[model samples]
Structures are given as C-alpha cells and as structure tokens.
Target: MSPPRQPLPHRGRGAVSSPHARFEPLAREGFDDGWDIAEEAPPLATDVAMEAARSIISRNDSPDIGFDRSINPYRGCEHGCVYCFARPTHAYLGLSPGLDFETKLFAKPNAAELLTRELSAPGYVPQAIALGANTDPYQPIERRLRITREVLEVLSKSGHPVGIVTKGAMVTRDLDLLGPMGRAGTAKVAVSVTTLDPVLARRMEPRASAPRKRLEAIRALSEAGVPVLVLAAPLIPGINDHELEAILEAAHAAGAREAGYVVLRLPHELKEIVRDWLVEYYPGKAERVFAILREMRGGRDYDAAFGTRLTGTGPYATLTARRFETALRRLGMARRGGLRLRTDLFVPPVRGAPGQLSLF
Candidate 1:
C-alpha cells in the first residue's frame, strides 16, 4: 500500500505536488512526526539537453486553432505560468509536469537544418508556419542559445511567411529579421500579456516578462512596422477576468493592431497544478473561482470538445465572449475573420549537385 502524500511547499513554481501518473497504481508520500518540516528547497537550476530532431514542423488538424502547421523550438517552457495547458506534455517524456517541466528543458539544435531540408524537398507546399505555438521560443534561455533566431534566419532567407506568439521581451532582439518580413507582409507577432498588475503577473507567470515590459515590446514591434497583437491569455475566473477590458485598452494604447484572449484551460495534470496554485495564493476565493469555472464548463473542471474547449459553455462563457467582442468594437480593433499571412513570397532553397554551377 502506498502512503498518503504530503503537500509540497511552494517553491516559486506552479505545481504544488508531482502526483504519480495515473498509469501507476501506487503513490508515494512524505511523513513527519512532531518536528517542524523545513520549507521545500527551490528546484534545481534548469538543465537543457540538445535534441536532434528529424522533423521541425508539426501538423495539427484541430478545428479551433487558426494554423495547421507550426514549429516548437523548445520542449517545456521556463516561464512557469501556472495556467499553461502545455505543461502536461512533459509527462510523455517521463518527467514531472510540475517543476520538471520548467527546470528541465530541451532544445532542438538541428531545427533550422531540418527546416531547410524539408523546405528544399520537392512537392513541398508553403503555408504560414506558426512559431512558439506550443512552448515559447523566446524564453530566457534564448538569450544564450539563440536557436529560435537561427530558425528565423532560415525562414527569412527562404521568404517564408511566419507568425510568432510569445511572452518574452527577448523577441525584440530579432527585429532585424522580423522587420523585413513584416514589411513584406510575411510576419506578425502576438505578445501575450496576461495582466497589467505587476504583483498578480509576478505570482501567476513568475519568470515571464513583466506586464509593462510586454507592452513596451508591443510598442517596439509596432514602431518597427511589424504588426503587433496583444494576447490577454488564460483569463482566470474571479482573478484576472475583471481586467479583460483594461488589458485590451492598454494593448491598443501601446499601438497593437489586434488583440485576443484565451480563457483558463486546465487539462490532465494541469488541473491539479492550477488548483494547488489557487489554494496557495488565493485561498479565500479559490472555491468561488472554481465554482465560476465549473459553471462555464458545464459543472466540470474542463471540457475538451472542439468548439467549446477554448471558450467554455453556458452563461459565463457567453458573457465573456460578448464582453470581448464589445470591447474590440469599442476600441476599433475588431478583426473580421483571421489575418492572412502571405505565402506567395516563399522561395524554396536551391540544392545544387556537388561541384556544379547553378543555372540562375
């Protein structure tokens, strides 16, 4: 028989406990007798492993998402946003989706090479490739590794249309690449700014760029002639939902041409992680917040259905959608349909035979 688990102390991370995987029937626990239990030590420093990937682009057929093809330069994000839905993907690597998902990272060092090879292949069709679709490409480690930048270099040389979504200010470092692409209508960027309150953002996102810094990035991107979109993502109920309008307003003032928002989504291991975070930081309102989410999700923690997953069902969901639309219309930022990224400019790489001159 397995012993009962003790609550893990908050360690400046999102998840409170690394619960055993459901595939395993047994669970482990820590026990104490009388003596005070010292606070849990901070997680170990981040460890990055280079991954040689055979393919860099991933295709998805999800009905709700905007793009069909995307690239993730890294596996596992260090931003440590408690509401991040991608955390559970770490379990597939036999790693804890809690702290391990943040501290243990993987980089696709061969991503650019693989991308060039794939693009050079015959019968290849070009479409707008989404960057940072799963894990952030501009996370802190990017300052040193620059794998994302290398991938951008390949994409730029090929004249491939690309869209980027990130919360890292480090993205500004690549203005030299994005600027030309943006002018050519081949690039657009969306900066995720969850909240304007520094304290709340600090607690919720931990290591991501500050709310104001993200705003600055938006402004910078706009001034560079790159179309900027502000994403007020993962709007937690009874938490940051009240600031929805304010976030959009701020983004518009920062020169963003478009805006988007995603309601909080908890799936698989993420459910327990978010719950733990709520109890630790907002114990008094935890129950109320969850109740509201349940109401929106049809009396459940989450609903993964195609149309209803991004925005929940029921009255609260409807109201949130209406509020977002109304705000967008009022701010004169309502976008009809989705923004079309240019594909006509794509130029496949030329692969010449060894020691042969190109017939230009």
Candidate 2:
C-alpha cells in the first residue's frame, strides 16, 4: 500500500497540499498521531521537463472565447494562481492538480519549430494565434528556456498576428519584436490584474507579477504601439470585487485601451484546492466568499455551460457586468481586445527552405 500523504505546509506556494488525482482508485491523507511523529517537510521546488508535442496549435470552437486557435509555450503554470481554471489539466498527465500543477512545469523547447511547420502547411489558415490561453507563455522558466521568445521570432518573421494574455511583467522584454508588429496592426496584449492589494495577490497568485507591475506592463505595451487590454480576471467577490473600478482606472491611466473580467471559476479539483486555500488564508471570510461565488454560479461551485462559463448568470453577475461596462465607459476603454490584429500580413515560410529565408 502507498504511504499516507500529509497536507503540505505553505512554503511560498499557492497550494498547501498535493491531493490525490481524481482518477486514482484510492486516496490518502496524513493525520496527526498522538506521538506527533511527522516531521515538517521542506519547501517545494519547481521541476520542468521538455514535452515533445506533435502539434503546438490548439483549436477550440467555444463561442465564449475570442480566438479560434492558440499556442501554449509551456504547461503547468508556475504563477500558481489558486483559482486558475487550467490547473485541472495536470490530471491528464497522471499528476495531482494541486501542488503538481505549479511545482511540476513543462517547457516546449521545439514549440517554435513546430509552429513554423504548422503555419507553412498547404491548407493553413492565417489568424491571430492566442498565447497564454491555457498556460502562461511568460512564466518564470521562460527567462531561461527562451522558448516563448523563439516562437515570437518565428511569428514576427512571417508577419503573423499573435495575441498574448499574461500576468507576467516579463512580457515587456519582447517589445522589440512586438513593437514593429504592433505598428503594423498585428500584435496585441492583455494584462490581467486581479487586485491592487499586494498581500492578497501574493497569497492568491504567489509568483505572478504584482498588481502594480502588471499595470506598468500594460503601459509599456501600449507605449510600444501594441494594443493593450486589461483583464480583472477571476474577480473574487468580497475580496477584490470592490476594487473593480479602481483596477480599470489604474490600467487605463497606464495606457490600456480595453478591459474585461471573468468571475472566479472553481472547476474540477479547483473547488477543493481553493476551498482549502481560503480556509488557510482568509478563514474568517472563506464561507462568505464561497457563498457569493455559489450565488453567481447557479448555487454551485461552477457552471460550465457555454454562454455562462465566462460570464456567470444571476443578479450579482449582472451587477458585476454592469459595473464593468460603466467603468469602461468612464475610462474610454473598449470592452474587448481593442484592435484586430492584421492576418493579411502573414507570409508563410517556405516549407523546405533554410529558416533564415523566411525573414525576407
């Protein structure tokens, strides 16, 4: 039999436990024995492995999402947002969606090469390829791997439109490539700032850029001519929801021309993950937070219906939407990705030629 698993201590991580995968037939938990025999576990460190994916493009026909296709340069985000809807994807790899979702990361070293091949396919269609849709393309590992940068190089050479969504301030490092493309109307970026409270941000998203840094990233991207949109994503009620207008205002003052928001989503193991986190960090408000979320999510932890997935249904949801729209009007920010990136500029790379030839 497998050994019992104890709840992991918080070590600058969002998840305090590595729960059993839902697919596992048996579950294990550590309990305190009268002897107090268990020793404190050491802090968790991140582990990244290369994934040789057959394809880099992920196509989705969901009506709620804006893009038809997207690319994720990495998997299992290190930012470790407790409310991340993408965390459950770790289960597909036989890993726990708790700590495993953040500590066990994957880098797609060949992503650029694969993207080039796919974009050059005979029947390939040109459109804005979304980045950071599932996992953040600018996660900390990206600084060393440079996989996301390589992918951007390929897209820039072909004049392909690419839209990026991230909470990492490091995205500004690629402005040299994004600048010219933005000038050509072929690049855009969305910066999601969940709260202006640094303490809350640290506990909720342990490694993501601070709220101020994200706003600065928005300003930098906009100044470089890239269309910048601000996202008050996963806006937790009784937590950051009260700062909705303030977040939009800060983003607008930083030069963002668009804004959007998604209520907190607790899908799959996320429900348990977030519940535990709330009890640990905001014990006093945890019940009320869940109560408000349930009210917005049709009296459940989450609602996956197409139309209501991104924007929930009910009175609170309606009020949130109304407030968002009103804030946009006051700030003169569009309630979308702002400008359409130009797909007509795409220059397909010659399939069998040297990579350098594509730049011309």
Clashing pairs in 1: none
CA deviation > 4 Å runs, candidate 2:
1-8, 37-41, 352-360
Per-residue lDDT for 193 in model 2? 92
Give the lowest summed-lDDT range of ten residues in model 1: 1-10
lDDT of 1 by residue, 1-360 (tens): 344344455555655666555445566656665454556656657889999898999999998888899999999988888888898889888777787788889999889888888988888999989999999999988899999999999899889989999999989999999999998899999999899999998888888999999999999999998988888888998899999999999999998878888889888888888887888789999899889888988888888989888889888889999999999999989552256879998998755544555466
Instruction: Return model 1's CA RMSD, one decimal.
Output: 2.6
Per-residue lDDT tens digits for candidate 2, residues 20-76, read 888877787766555444456687899999999889999999988889999998989
Minimum summed lDDT over a 10-residue window in model 2 is located at: 1-10
Error of 1 at 275 (Å): 0.6
Q: Candidate 2: TM-score? A: 0.94
